[model samples]
Target: MLRRNPIDFFNLIWSDEAVQKISKNTDLITRSKIEQNQENLKPHSRLRKWSSPSKADIRRLMGIVISMGVIRLPSITDYWSSNNVLCIPFFREVISRDKFWNLHVADPLPDNVSYPSKSYKIQWLLDHVNMRSQELYEMGQNIAVDETMVKFKGRIGFRQYNPKKPTKWGMKLFTLADSNTSYMWQQNLYVGADGRETELSKCAQHVLDLVEPLSNLSHTVYADRYFWTLGLAQRLIDSGFNINGTVMPNRKGFPQRLKSAKHMKPGEIIAFRKDDILMLQWKDNRVVTMITNNCRSDEWCTIKPKNPNHDTRNKPKCIADYNKHMNGVDVNDQLCTYYL
Candidate 1:
C-alpha cells in the first residue's frame, strides 16, 4: 500500500458547466409556464414567490434544498426556526423559508398542454437530467441494470410498492449503472401509463431501452430475473453484447425437467444450452437458476460464507460473477441514502 494525493487520480469527467446550462434552461421554462397561468388567477392567488423565477432565484432555492439534506431536520419549519437560522449563517443569508417552500420546477399550464401519465409534471427536467448523464461520462465494458426506488409519499399516480425496499411507497426508476463505480449512466421513470402506453407494454423493453446506447460496444451486462429472458439473451447476443443474470423458474422456455425435479441435494447442478443462451440451476440452500451467454459451463469458484454456521463453498462462474458485479445500482442507492 502507498500513500498518495487523492487529487492526482481523481477524474472529474462530469461537467458542472453543462449541468448549469440545463438548470438555466429549466428555470426559463418553469418561469414561462407559471406566468402563463398567473394571468387567469386573482391578484394574490397565483404563486407569490414563483410568479417570475430568475436563474439566480432558482439556484438559491436549490442550495436551500441541498442544505436541508445535510441539516437533517424532521420538518421544513424546523429549518427556518430562529435557533437554526441563527446558527446556520449560509441559510440565513441566502433565502427565506417561504420562498423555498414555493419553489416549483415545472409550470402548471392551461388545458391545452396535455399531461403525461408517466411523468406529466417533471418530464422536461427528467429528460434533461438523463441527457446530461450521457454527456458527462462514457460507460465501461461491464455494466449492471436494476430498479431504484425514490421515496415520495404524497398522493400521486405511479407510486410503487416494494416490501423489500426501505421506502415501500414511492416512485420507481429503472437504471443502468457502471459495475465498478456505481455511476448511473441512464435512467427511466416508471410511470404506469402516459395516456397512450401502459407499463405492461414496456416491461419487456426495459433492458433494451436503458442499454441501447451501449449496443455494439461489446459490453457485458448483469441484471436480475426481472429483465433477463431467453429471447432477450438471444437478442443481446445478436447485437454483439453478452448478458448474465438469474432467471425465474416460471419464465417461458425453461426446461420442464428442471422445473419438475425435486429432492435435489446441495451443490447439485442442472444446465440447459441453446446456441448462445445457457441456463443452469445449482442446488444451494435453495435452487438457484442462472442464465448467461458468455460464461463457461465447467467454470467453478469459491466464496467464504458470512454465516458462522457455514464454511467456504464452491459456486458456478455465472453465480459468482452475478454476485460480484450485479450490485452497481445497490451501491449507488446506499451512497445516496447517506446524504438523504
Candidate 2:
C-alpha cells in the first residue's frame, strides 16, 4: 500500500480554544481603549461608539497585512487613494483603517489565572506557528541552523539589534531549515541570551531542538562558525548525527597545535581526529579551520575561483559541502526580502 505524505498527514495543531482566547483578549483591549477615550471626551463633543472585533475580523486584519506586503503601498490608506491599486475592487469593505490601526492580539495582564507571568504578548501565536511549521513537514537529511531577524523597530523588551543583518533592528529568530529546499522545519524566538547556558551550549541546544524529530535518523547537520564547537560535534556524533561546520580558533576544546601557523602549499591539510570527531585546518590564501563528525578530513576537492584568471584552489571535501549547504538560511532570508 502507498503511504500518505507526512506533510498531508499532519493537521493544524493551532487550537480553536487558543484562537478564542486571543480574540477575546483583543476585543477586551480595543473596547477598553475606546471607553477610556470616551470618558476623556469634552462635554459637547460627540463620542464615536464602536463594537469589538470578532475572530473573523482579526483574520481579515491579518490578511490585510499580508496584502500590504504584496501591494507595497506607502501607507494603509494608500490602497484607497493611490492610483496604482485603484483598479482593484473591494478595497475598503474588507478592512477599514480604523479596524487595522486598533487591532490587538492580547490584553496586558500580570500573572493572572488566565495569563502566565512569563508568557509574552504574542506567545500564543508564536507557539502555534512553531508547532504547525514543524508538524507539516519532515526534515531532509541535510539541515542547517541559523538566525533570521523579523523587522520590528517598535518598543519591545525582547527586540534585538544586529548591525550585520539586513534588518538590523527587529526580533531575533533562530531557525532550523532543510538545506536542499530551504524549508523551515523549526524555529524559536531568541528571547535574549540566557545567562545559565554558555554561548556554545545555547547554539547546540537550538540545533538539537530543531532536529529533535530526526535525532536517530543518521542525518548530517551544517552550521556556521557561531554554532559549531568541538563539544557540540562530539555530542551530536554520540546521538547518531553527523555534523560539519566552520570553527573559530578561540573556541573551547580547539587544539592549540592546530592553531600554529605553518608555511604550507594549497591543498595541504592537517587533520586531528578523536574517535568519530575530526578537526581539519586547510591552507589556501589563509588557513580555514573546520570540524566535522563523519567526514574524512583528508579528502580534498578542486575549487575554481569566481575570477577566471585566478588559479583554481583546493578545498577540503567538508568545506566544499559546508559552503554548499550553509546557504539554506541565507537563501530563505533572500526569498523573504524579495517578498517584502
Candidate 3:
C-alpha cells in the first residue's frame, strides 16, 4: 500500500466548515466578479432546451471560487479541488490570472498562461517599504549606513571588452535603523563604482538623500573614518545633528616642541601646556592625553593608565616616542578636546 500524502489530510481539514469559518471570514459571493458577470451574460432566447443551473450547481461553483480565493495560493490545490485554481485573494478582491492578464500583462499574452507583469508588483512593494521607513523615522531613531559588493554572473574579461565589468554589479546599501528599538527604518540600494574619492563622494550623497527626510527626529548617523570627512562633519553639525563617531586623523601636521620632552618618563606628565591638559605615557607602551572642557588639573589626575609598563619593548613609549612611532598620534587628546 502507498502512503497517503500529508497535504491530502490538510485538504480535508481545510474544507471543513469550522476551519473555513476560522480561516476565512469573507462571504464567497462578495469574493469575486465572476458571479456578477455570470448574471449579466445574456442567453439566446431561441435555445429552448437550456436551463439555469440548479441551486446545488450554484453552490458548487461558489465553493470553487471560494477555494481559489480564500485559500492561500501556496496551499490552494490542497484546500480546494477545482479546475480554475489560479486566483488569489488579496486586498479584499480575487485576483485571477485571466483578469490580471487582461488588465496589465503584455500584449499577445503567451500561449502558456502566466501571472501578471512583475514590474508593477516590484514598484508596489518598493512603495510599501518606503512608507514603512517613513513611519519608523518619525519615531526617533538612529540610522547606520553601509555598503557591500555583488558580483555579476556574466563575464567579458579584465582590460578586455567584458560585459561583466559594465553589467556585473555591486551595490551600496543605506540602512536606517532605530537604536533603541532595534528596528530597521529604511534601505536604499545603489550601484557600486571605482574606489576613487569622487565616486565614493557620490555614493555618500545618495545615502544622505535617504537620511535627510528624517532630520526632524532625534536621529544620529554612525559611520567609519572614511565616511567622516571634515566637510561632511561640518555639514552634519550645521544641520543641528550630534555626531559621535571616530574623528578622522589629520594627514599633515607639525611636531610639537616641549622644553622638558627629554626628561619625560613613561607614565609621567611632561607638561600641562596652555590648555588644561595632561599628557601621560607608560613603559608598557600605552600613551594617552587627557583633556577636559572644565580645564582643571584634578580632571587629569583622575585618569589612570591601563598599562603601567611604558618603557618595556612590548609597550608604547613616551609621548615623544609615540609621536615617532605612530603615524597619526601627533594631535594629542588635549589638542582635540581644546579645538572641538
- In terms of TM-score, how similar is model 2 to the real structure? 0.82
Backbone clash count, each prediction separately: 0, 0, 11
In the order shown, the candidates' Cα RMSDs to the true structure are 4.6, 4.5, 18.5
Candidate 1 weakest ten by summed lDDT: 6-15
User: Can you write out model 3's per-residue Cα lDDT over 1-340, one digit (the tens) per residue?
Assistant: 9889965643433334433332232223222323445556456321222233333333343445555444445643333224345533341243333222222111222235563433222333344556655653454434454432223333422111223322234332445554445344565544333344542266456556656776645455654434544445445545555443322233112124331245455655422333222222222233233211122332222223458864323322222222222221112212322322
Could you give the candidate ranking by lDDT, starting with the highest? 1, 2, 3
Give candidate 3 regions above 4 Å deviation. Answer: 1-124, 148-171, 192-200, 247-340
How does residue 39 of candidate 2 score in lDDT?
Answer: 68
Model 2, 1-340: lDDT tens digits are: 9887643432254345655666788777766565677767666432243466677776676567657777775566677563654534455778765566667766556334463323367776777777787777788889888999989877877888899888999888888888999987777887765566554578777777777778788889898888877778877877789998888867787778777747767757788887878888888778888888767966778989899999997778999999989888888888887646
Q: Supply candidate 2's per-residue lDDT for 103.
A: 71
- What's the lDDT for candidate 1? 0.76
Model 2: lowest-lDDT 10 consecutive positions: 6-15
Better of 1 and 3 by lDDT: 1
Worst ten in a row by lDDT for model 3: 325-334
lDDT per model vs. reference:
0.76, 0.75, 0.38
| Candidate 1 residue lDDT tens string, 1-340 | 8886743322132234433544555556556656677767567643544544455666676668766777786677766667834356667578766556566665354467677454766776677667877888889888999999998888877889999888688889999999999998888999874344533335557788888888899999999988777777877788888889998867788898678657789989888888878888898889888999888788999888899799888999999999999999999988877756
